[model samples]
Target: MKKKCISGLVMLLCVMLVSTSVLFAAGSKESGASNEVDKIKSRGVLNVGVKVDVPGFGYKDISTGANVGFETDLARQIAKVILGDASKVSFTPVTAKTRGPLLDTGELDIVIATFTVTEERKLSYEFSTIYYTDAVSLLVKKSGGYKSLKDLDGKTIGVAQSATTKAVLETEAKNQGITLKFSEYASYPELKVALDSGRIDSFSVDRAILMGYVEDSSEILPDKYSPQEYGAAMKKGNLALLSVVNSTIADLDASGELLAMKAKWGLDK
Candidate 1:
């Protein structure tokens, strides 16, 4: 009888150990699944990716030495929603080529760098509701005498590398029966310099971005092409974070803050 009781006690101990281990494993998975938003809250800071060169959208103000643009404002607004304070945000300047990868690698909590939403990108990242709409257009020297897409035939246009603008321009050119040469630059500033130096006949990008570089000698084509909706982007599978972002954007729209931001950044025009 004594031997039997000792064996039963040992069996119970083994079962309890196994049950505890199983519970721990399950809890770890649940923790991992919801950790993104929780991590941000614990840190009390939101890391936002933005462009430093696009003037009205996300650029560094020379006077304040701080980023000031529509996207910048949106990032701050998101920080407010997440952390209860708009100032609890850090901005990282990212280029078109680097934005997606940085977001993937956890270097950024969210990206608001005029990132356009597309079907292809949806596979890799989650996008918030469309916050802004922009159209692709051309910027050329007024003296270049390029009136329309047809005039771009055999001319070189400068575009940022890894951007959708080049592909959009190619499609439009094909429809117009124009054959164009494209010069790729790493950033908008490089493309702007190429256009100014006459290395390229024109620079192509979102009209709102090109508007920042427009000068007395430069002109934006009157006709806009290829409308795109801009959204904030984050790593895929973060439903909680996405929900927060979508809700914030909805609130901004409902409260007319989005429209006010557009006007403040010169996008309302």
Candidate 2:
């Protein structure tokens, strides 16, 4: 009888021990789990990807050595909304090809780098509503006598990799009965160099981006096509952060601050 009692007590203790361990394990997991917004808040600084080369949108100001532009300002606004301080944000310069991979690696919390929203991209990442609209345009040297895209038939045009310009222009070329050859560059500065060195007859990308590279020697051809809508992007399943971003953009637009910011950077045109 005593042995039976002892065995029963041992079983009860074992059950209690197992229950305690299960509770402890669950508690550890619950304590460790945090959503996207909580992670950003815990860090106290928002990390964003931006373009360092495109002026009026994102660029490094030489005198200040600070990034300044419409999109940079947007990042600050987003940081302020999320972290309660505008200055508590960091920028990682990203190009067309690097932005997606950076965002995929969890190195960046968000991308404010003139990311164009497309049906194809929505499959990979979550994007905010369109914050800015622009059209793909061309920049050609005046000496080339290239009056329009149609004039550049059989001529090679420079385009940025991972941008929609090349595809849109190809369709336009087909419609206009002109065949265009394209040379892809990783950056706008490189494309400009290609144009300057006679390797490419024209530089083509979003007009807002092209504006920064235009010079006394080159002019943006009066051709614009395929409206591109810019949106901020984050990895899929970051709905907590995406909700905040989308709401912040809506508030900015509703308050007319978005337009004012655009005008401040001469982007309202």
Question: Per-residue alpha-carbon lDDT of model 2 for 116-167, expressed as tens digits?
Answer: 9999999999999899999999999989988999999999999999888899
Which tens-of-lDDT digit does each residue in 1-269 have in candidate 1? Answer: 99999999999999999999999988876667468888999999999999999999999988889999999999999889889999999999999899999999999999999898999999999999999888999999999898987888999989888899989988988888889999999999898899999999999999999999999999998868888899999998777788899999999999998999999988998
| Clash pairs detected, candidate 1 | none
RMSD (CA, angstroms), candidate 2: 6.5
Off by over 4 Å in 1: 1-33
TM-score of each candidate structure, all chains considered together:
0.88, 0.87
